[model samples]
Target: MIGGIVGIDQDIVKADVTPQVDTANTDISTNYIATSNDYGKIGGENGSDWTIDSNGVLRIQSGTWNDESVAKFWSSLKSDDGSNINAGNKITSVIFEGNIITGNSLASLFDSLENLKSVTVALGAKFDTSKTEDFQNMFSNDSSLESIDMHMFNWENVTSSLSMFYQTGLKSVDMTNINAPKLSDASSMFYNCKSLKSAKFDGTNFSKDGVKLPQFLASCSDLADVSLQNSFTGKITDTSLMFDGDINLEDLDVSSMNLSSDTKTSFMFQTSNNVQDIRRKSITLPADPNITNSKIDEYNTDRYKGWSSNLSGDIVPSLETYYSNNANVGKTTWTLVEKDKSQYKVNYIDQDGNLIETKNESGIIGNPINTTKILGYSDPKNSESQPDLMSIADNNDQEFNIVLKKLAPYKVKIDVEYGDGHPSESFSVDIPYGLTSSSAQVDQSILDKLASNDSLDLDKSKAFIQRIASGNPATEGDGFSLSTVISGFNIDGSDFKSIFNGTIDFVNEQVDSAILEGASGQTFDAFEIYFDKYEQSESHNNGGSTVSKEITDINQKSATFGDKETKLYNSNGVLIPNIQLAKNSDWKNDKQMILDGTKYYRVSTDAWVKASDVYVYTDNISKIRVHADNRSRIIRPNGDLSDRALEKSTEWKTDRYTTINGEKYYRVSTEGFVKASEVSEYK
Candidate 1:
């Protein structure tokens, strides 16, 4: 081929040279590493050589490579080309400086270097998703790698999908010096680093305007402590699983943390609301300024503390003494107070020199015992006046009864006291018994004497007799009058006088009237006198007969006139006056006129001895009788005399007639012969 194998040899030589050239061209075209600068050009001009020094700095020698250039170079190095530099070799260390490696290609570089121990990227090197598959798995299998300081780069919008520190053997981490000005979207940048012990978030580059991520340093059980800057405004919604298995985080300070609505189920301790300081062993309660012994007892009881007598020993000195002294007091403060007029409140204190409770017992002070009057009478002791005693009993159910005897009128005092030191006071009621005539003041000395005595057993019977003996005398001529006494005693005087006078006078009058009216031969005229006198005098002058003998004399004269009848006859004895036939004669018509044997009356005057006078025998006439035997018997016998006689007898027989000679007779009837019509015309 020296110009196509020199002409004649030229033709054959030319053909050989063309095939050789074509073969070389095909090799060049297919080998990307050979053509790429990704591998070293046959001279030492391209490709990257990574080296590590004893000082742990990773040195990388490259020619004009940025992150894209280094990534392309590493891609060639990991390819299967014969000219590739680090293919299938264990890289013990890598020192890279001033390189811009990024994207999934850069991660592929580290993945091929299985034995890589140390890698050092340049100070301004930024590895991104395109240069590597998130670069997170770049150091994933590199357990020998110990440290990483990626602070120099501006990781501002760099999405850290890589958790390069997780698989590496890192014992400690320091995030204090990191200035993540644009790292707002980094949620869990170091979520599961178990070897991490300490972390710091004291920078001002953090934004407070969004929902914060939880467990940013979560499962690092060795991470017992953390510090947060005051300028942090991240919201924590779910911190529950953040420390789920952390046992050493007892005193966590969450005071500066703000929570969102989703942050609710965080607390795990009992009495969570009562916990104040998270660093202390016990919590302080609200200050109870007035703690009483009773309150303490109640608290103790509620807490199930056993009862002890010493519980109240710490009470206020005053209250303690009151409790110890007054055994009747109850367990509450209000019970210690006495509800009465005095209104005294007891001051209670506890052992801590603080006032606990107060009790008021002043209500009962100065209250007097109530007294009531009981009506009663004492036994009579004297004849003159009775010693009636009135007593008073205190109405207080707690006190005893006291008897107060009468000392005088209109004033009564009870002598009693409440208790030992209380003196007996003199109290009097306005109204008193027995002395109505005059207002009299009770003798204090007498009451004092009576009160001082233990018993009230006086001889009231003897006293009464002595009082009567010493009574004021009645005035002269002021004889005891039943009417006056009865009026004073408010009794009916007439009834009293009637009771005082015996019934003997009335009985005697009744007996005498009965005897005169029912006697066998007594004249009715005599009975009239007695009955009239008795009736008129029964109630007057105590039944003394006010009518005297003159009345009796007139009665006797009337009786005699009624018993006798006188008839006037003509001198011729020619029946001039016939008592029965003189019905028209004025003289004969007198009520005193009667027909009798002493007064003659003729039936006819035709022919007869012209008798000068006629008279009926009256000397044989009996006293005027109310009943008679017959009309012509000259003395009353059983009546069968004659029709005329019977008729005359029937006329004389009445309730007003008297009996004479066993015949009925009126006051006008005479004890004389019968009429001539009865003697002659009937025969």
Candidate 2:
């Protein structure tokens, strides 16, 4: 050793060593340490250990090594046996080229580098599939790792259970030959790795042949878009659920797939092709072409044209074209085409080969015609000019113009002709000037008042008058009283009484002189006159009772009875006092006698006796006579009998006999007799 004293110049170092023990030039190994020379080489049997700074980049010396030198050196050196470097050491970058690094056994050689930033296995290098576990573990702990290029090796027989690839900050992954098949459970394989923007899959190699598609893109919330390159032939039982969880994906295209309408809920499309065929065929249009005409008439009119045209072509042109031509001339033609009664199809065709429109035979002949003829005009030849009749001679023609008067309108008689000569009889309807009473009134004030007030109250007023006067009682001298006439007739009964009594007095004075002595002239019998007077008094009393009871019942039932005492009929069927009850309370007794027509009375009977008189028994025997005329007699203490007569009694006689002062007294009467008299002093 020529004095291993190293001379150091500023930043340059030079070292020289002489081989003491040299066996062969290839087997000779040298170790040298140089400081800052920028150029050095060591020939060795074993690979040299190169130590770089903490942040230094180690690369193969390119310019100094020729192809022959690299070949000779690398061939002789043991190929990168990393036994010198410990496992789990830090590494910055790893790159390999040529045959230096061969199999994944090299991965084990670098497995100790936990802080590896990048790993690029060169082409033609073999990756040991069994060491996938080792490399996976290495990558899992290595957070500084940025990229991995395993494209060189076909990673067959590699069972990679590493989900760490997704967790890593891997910008790109080259899994070109991954051979594992059961990847159905690998959900979110690339979840949240926003750095990964582009990816591609070869359909042949990376196809989801039996694998479900949802497993591939599940939980990919950021995956807002998707595209399919080819037709999807797989059976997607529920395509709706495929995108059910992808809320961000607003649109999808299943146009490439053969989707069935049966499974689709809402298939909105431009045509009916997307809908089931049966539904599209069910739509139909109505048979009648003209909307203005009734459907029945359109059918019948077509039939009439067909029938008339079939008689002769000259009489009626082709039935189909007749209406079209006539419609231009403002005329409509009815067609009646012949048909086989059983078959509804119109068999006849026009010269133009159009089917002749036909009406249904059942509908045409079976329809019952309903027509009404209104009275058009009325002719009055001549009428006398009276206060009530129109004058015909007043006009120059001496004929009354009996045209239907607008003032008193009358409707025409209408008759309906049903089939088979059956004609409905004509009837007349009174033509009302207006719809209702309110409309008929010309005055706006009256119409307004009528509308504002209830019509029922006015109807009640008319009914009130009719209810009080309706019966034989009003004519039978038993009429309404002062109170009832005031309430029911809605007038002052005292004023009515004054007017009526004055008329009666005037009539009586006129008849009084004529009736005084006449058997020849209009004579009045005193008894008949007296009976009429009595009946008038009785009727007045009874009519008042009926009206009072009706008003009372109405007032009691209604809480809203006004102060003006509204007159009402007895609708509740309350009995009027002094009116006789029906013989049977059941109201079905026809044999019951009619009192005042609407009432019945119970019948009564009485017994009659004759009195006997004696003259020898001196108990002041008095003789009295009773007449068959209705009268009564009573004996007085002065020995005189007072006589009272019944107005219209039919029969009467003595009721008893008495004896006084040794003389028998006879009780006799034109009416019934009462004989309890004192004896006279002369007797």
Candidate 3:
């Protein structure tokens, strides 16, 4: 066995015998029989060099060999010798390649290879398992075999798989490689492969008569992932304990299974407590499954959602069907607010996850734009209408409009001189439309900016600017306070002249909250207004004037009307535009007087006046009116203070006069006299 004599492992007295290993592989090795079906005796106690050590691993040359030779090599392990070789106990791994297996059944080929950790079936290696039905103990008790790549091994016509892979040390196995088209009886096929984690079998293999899978993977605690739909579609009926002990299975999606006609599914998932979801919640039932001795009652939740059958024995959906049935029950509500041009309009939830119909860009009220409020959807832009002018007018979309439509209903009010704890500074109140208050009480609609903790409406934040500018009523809820959202839409120092201060900042603020979807009518509380003062332009007490002054203070001859009524006298000694009053001969000299408890002033002998009703001026003339009973107070148009009654019967003419709060008086010639309502040209 030295170098001088060719080594026992390499002795080749004959010529080279090379053959094709597979379609594309040629046997170039000098030792292996290069042809298939050589059937030479392989491993045994005899002269055959093939031998599995006490460790049970067949140590062969690391190269491709003929399948027939490999088969013979394996068969020798179970040869009819008076002494049984340690075939089952010692052969742990096989490293051989061949295709001659097409002539034989590999039923117990590697069954007892208890320590066999892995097997690499060579290319073109086909097992003629078509005619043979039994595959009992195929790789049984191979505890050390971690995996076997049988992709090249075909089992197209195999029918049975009892104890096929029982007690193996495999990690994951895809039995789809073994195309068992006629496989029906698969009981205990993978029983107790404790180390097995996943088992994926081909569905086509079980297309034949259904395969009974009772206790097939029983007690395989670590086998969490399983896939065997072939049995459901085939003629295999009895599946009593298919996954009887798969305790840690997380989810099982069986929606693809068509178990339309099965006889028994009792205890299919018996004691497998941890298995959670079994989808396609229902399994088919036979027209008449004999469950007299079965545990069908235990098949309710531990396995499928529910297993039920009436007189017709058809399986019905389980309670999990609720999800598959109710699709719209949880629809969310929200508005898709886009800048419609110059203003903002809220496209509220109108239909399935979409906004209501809206007038198109055309004033003609074109097809309503169904706004999308879907989570993953982006609203279409003006891009929908190609080549159309980006113009808002060319488009009825009113953001481009000088006047807003949707936000027009809302408002903001600016009440000046807000004197709280501060130094009586002026502030603005940005309230919703229809909100009323006192002060300048200007009582008029004013566009004011808000600055406070008011939230930007969740969905309406997108275009809150337009909403505020147009005074859209936040009537729905306590609308968003423009203050908090705006921060500063244009408050110069303290002047709130514009809502464009934090234009970009505010838009960023609403971008997130505004687009968030909501429940059907969810609303925000009132937008508590906040204010930024513009250097306190003007301040005072409770929005009132800081200083009080009358016109008389500026001009000695002019004064605001006082509280009392007054009278005047005419130099002509006759009362014109006559009215009834307490007449007396008052000679004159007094420009102010008091009658009873009120103050008064006399402009002429025929004219008497209430202090508050008279606006004094050096030469100012106001048209007088005869309201109710006009007392006797006559006067010449010039300037007079007398107690003579005005002659209402005399037809006096006036050249010019002024009206106050609608009441009018006239100057007649060089004398004063009649109420415009009661004289010529007065009306």
Candidate that scores best on TM-score = 3
Ranking by lDDT: 3, 1, 2
Q: Write down the lDDT that model 3 would get.
A: 0.40
Q: Show model 1 residue runs off by greater than 4 Å.
A: 1-58, 61-89, 99-141, 184-188, 204-215, 230-232, 235-240, 248-251, 254-258, 262-683
lDDT winner between 1 and 2, please give it. Answer: 1
Cα lDDT, all candidates? 0.29, 0.26, 0.40
TM-scores of the models, in the given order? Answer: 0.27, 0.21, 0.33
Q: Give the per-residue lDDT digits (tens) of candidate 2, residues 547-580.
A: 2110100000001111122121122223334433
Worst 10 residues of 1 by lDDT: 525-534
- RMSD per model, one decimal: 66.3, 54.2, 39.1
For residue 82, give model 2's deviation from the true position in Å: 20
Error of 1 at 475 (Å): 99
State the number of backbone clashes in model 3: 100
Show model 3 residue runs off by greater than 4 Å.
1-81, 102-104, 123-132, 202-204, 228-231, 272-683
Question: Considering lDDT, which of the candidate structures 1 and 3 is the better prediction for this target?
Answer: 3
Deviation of model 3 at 236, angstroms:
2.4
Candidate 1 lDDT by residue in tens digits, 570-654: 4232343455322211111111111211222233232111111221121121112211223333322112232322322233221
lDDT at position 336, candidate 2: 37
